[model samples]
Target chain A: MSTLPLISCRGLKKIYPLSGVEVHALRGVDLDIERGEMVAIMGPSGSGKSTLMNIIGCMDLQTQGSYYFDGVNTSDLDARELAALRNKKLGFVFQRYNLLPRASALYNVEIPLFYSGMYGEEVKNRALAALSRFGIDELADNLPNQLSGGQQQRVAIARAVVNDPLVVLADEPTGALDTTNSLEVMNILQKMHIEQGVTIIIITHEPEIAGFCPRKLIMRDGKIISNEISSSDVRSKEV
Target chain B: MSVRFRVLSSFSIDALKANKMRSFLTMLGVIIGVAAVILMMSIGQGAQQQVLSRINSLGSNLLTVMPGAAGQFVRSGNVNTLTLKDAQAIAKLTGVARVAPTVRGNTLATCGNKTWTTEISGTTQEIADISSLEVELGRFFSETDVAGISSVAVIGQTVYENLFDAGVDPVGSEIRLSGISFKVIGLLKSLGASSGGPDRDDTIYIPVTTAQIRLLGKTDQSVNQIQVQVQDLNQMGTVQDEITSLLRKRHRLSDQADDDFNIRNITQLQTAAQNVTGILTLFLAGVAMISLIVGGIGIMNIMLVSVTERTREIGLRMAVGANKQDILNQFLYEAILLSLTGSFFGIVFGIAGSKIFSHFAKWSTAISIQAVVLSVAFALIVGVFFGYYPARRASRLNPAEALSFE
Candidate 1:
């Protein structure tokens, strides 16, 4: 594999103006992640982990940063260009599943495809194939509310990977799930990273949840305190 | 792009259907506004048409020469400015088809013990053709009768019912007019009521010479009015001008002085009535347009509430790669669908309401296609105008803050 990183950020900083006072959410952070790597970010609340995730996801602009995704400078893109990049190259999974309550599972999985200009039976077949990867294709016609927490999460995962994005950023993906559902979700993420060569980044406060990844970064006071690689999960086999 | 548009529309439709009652209530204002516009325009159009047709039914090429100055508000009864010689002079004009000098009086008619008082009009034989009068039972008196000063009368339908027995022929019967015995020679057809408040069927016609010599007892050749018919309606203005000049010259009136007579083309009154109706319709539509604006405001209010309620959904879509324009298109499409559906139902109701109004009020109503098309276009514009703000508000939301909102 090439040595170029999938994501690289240098001296990233974020500040918010609140009530005529400046609140520094992130002072400066530097990070790098290789392709096909499964990584986790660990932090307590208000530790700026969420802020970093938002900037890396292209949903927001950092106050001061030099960030590159696949060697393209993010600051060079406009709002619409950022949206197109998000549509084509990135995916996200949230803890709450964030599924449209009224839409069927099949339609929920089809959201990214819809934005990518895909139509007709190709869209349906791709969404169905994504759902089948998680063994929930039979529940495609069911609404989000009709499924269990585990099934809903699986559908959300199906949606996140339906477009075969370059990287998947999950924010507290297992936070709202029970132990059984959480383990099942983490296993699915692991399988997606290993089998499909998809780079994965999961944020969590739980050490056991972070244990599922091969590498983990701990953040405090808007700065990275530790970056550790687990000795047992040396499973970086390229596809 | 079209596929994305389809997706957005489906999302809009689904959202609207989720709250069916709210959607319908939001549409109510547009419905009523469009219906009112249609109803008002139809009523105005129908009244104008009816008035014109009534005036036309009197006679298409007819003009009345009244004994007053034009545009005068008040006048004394029976000015005696017109005479039979003036009618003869007008009849000699180039485009005059017929001229009848008219004399009017009120007197009691008695046949046996029954007596009823009614109006009496005196004219020559040309009055029948000029006024569109028909003899239902008998014949009109001849012009020779007028020349000989014969005391022959034609009783109208109302007079026949009042003075003569029912199912009995009144022609050739004698009826005393103000104690002067006259032969009833004909029964005039029923002409119904004029909009000017006169019962046209209640009059009796006699020879102008007879009325002047015997009944009215007038020494001079004065007449109440003159009725003139022209060969063509388009020539009425020229004929009127010619008669004015001729009369002015004969009367020896100067240019600075107003003439003592007024010549009214019935078509002018028809046009005036039409103008009044048109103004009334425009006024009503203006009021209805206010309500349509109010309805648009109602749509705006609901869309604002919808945007607030669906904040989380908007955040989710944005996170999933939907852009600002996508969010805008979704909400805008929802609002447009609501208003357009309301307009469709409003058109159906407007037509039905016009029919019901005409049936109940005994008024004529005609729905115009122009009104329908204009109102629909207006309603669509209202939807877009009102829906734009709320959709913009939705599109401008911060995805991070919106997602974190409860």
Candidate 2:
């Protein structure tokens, strides 16, 4: 890999003004994540984890910051350019799975590829491959509401990596699942990391969820207080 | 970009299908508006055509001079101040081609065991040329018959049908009129119902001399109306002025006497009627356009609701890779599809509705291809105009806020 970090940010800050009162969500956050690293950001409510995720995902503009993805500065891009950058380089998974209610799982998985300029039968094939990788290709034609929670998250993950994005940012990927389904989803992410060398950043408040990631960052009051690397690989195949 | 647009359009159609009933209800306004406008426009055009055709039958480049001032209270054909001498004087005017003096009287005619009441128009041989009256079979009165007061007549089509067999020639047949047996010398072709006037085919023509002295028993040389044919249509006004001056001089009428005559320019009246019909059509179309606007508003209303309801979906699409333009295109296509679909059905129903209306209402309706094209084009304009705001609103949404929205 290149010497430059895969994800880097300096002096990131986000502020919101509500009816004349200033609410600072993130204050002077600085971090660097290397390539092929599976990391988890663990923080309680109002800890700015989701805000940081949104900024890193290029879905929102930062009030004051410099962010670089794969060594390209993000602060210099316009809205359309930022969208293009996100389309080509980044993928996101939300806590709720955020699949279009009207589309089938296969179409949901094809969304990122569509943005990445894939067309027709090729897009369908890539989407099917991603769905099968998660062992949920049989449910590809089912809508989000038709699938179980675990199946829905599998479809969401399939969508997140369909374009082979440089980094996948999943916020609370297993937040809505029971313990049995949660472990199943964590195993898929683990398989993606080891087999495909995909970089992933998952945000969660559960310690159990954080334990699955090799590296964990604990945040409090909009700042990371601790960054830990565990030597023991947590491998429990529940599927 | 083209592929993206295709996908977006398909998604728009899918979105519309998701709320099938709402989309259809939104399109209802456009359908009714287009149908009503086209129907009224066609009917108005048909009426104008009918009036113009009726007026054409009176002959081209012709003018009528009657005895009194024309007004709402002044009825034609009763003024007795006009005379055959005045007609003769007008006939001599420069630019006047021919003149036919007419003295009309309702008379009863009996042939064999049949009797029918028809107007007897006492006119000279020039009446045929001045009034576009054609002799379908046999011949009109010769100059010998008119000058000699011969008791010969030409029967109109309705008169021939009433007094004789359908296919039998009535030319050589003799019929008794006011107890006088006059030989029918000609058969005039049919002239159907005019604008609001009596059917021309229901009249019988006789020599003016015979009707004045032998049948009606009038000593005064008076005529009801004089039909004058001008040499050129462009010289009508000058010919009319010349006739007015000649008649005034011959009658020894003073300047204040109002000419004791009225000149009717049939073509002028036709043009005036055409203009009135055109304005009426425009007025009706304007009212119908109001309904189209209302229909567009209905589309706007529903699209706004749809955009708001699908906020989360929009957010998800943006998160995946869609830009603002993609969202805008998808919503705009939905609106356009609804209006265009409504317009198609509107055109079909408009044509069929006009046919049904004409059949039962006894009013003529002509569906012009321009109207169909214009309605469809206008419907497209309405779709773009009303659908833009909602689509823009959907596009301007912040993806982060939208995805988080419930």
Candidate 2 lDDT over B312-345, as tens digits, reads 9988888877888888999999989999998988
Q: Individual DockQ of the candidates? A: 0.57, 0.46
RMSD of 1: 4.2
Q: What Cα-based lDDT does every candidate model obtain?
A: 0.88, 0.86
> Interface RMSD in Å per candidate, to 1 decimal?
1.1, 1.3
Question: What's the distance in Å from true for residue B207, model 1?
Answer: 3.7
Docking class of 1: medium
Tell me how far the alpha carbon of residue B235 in candidate 1 is from the true structure, in angstroms, after superposition: 5.5
- Best by the DockQ measure: 1
How far in Å is the alpha carbon of B351 misplaced in model 1? 2.6
On residues B262-320, what C-alpha lDDT tens digit does candidate 1 reach at each position? 89888887888788888877887778778878888999999999999899888878877
C-alpha RMSD between model 2 and the true structure: 6.6
- Candidate 2 residue B329 Cα shift, in angstroms, is 0.5
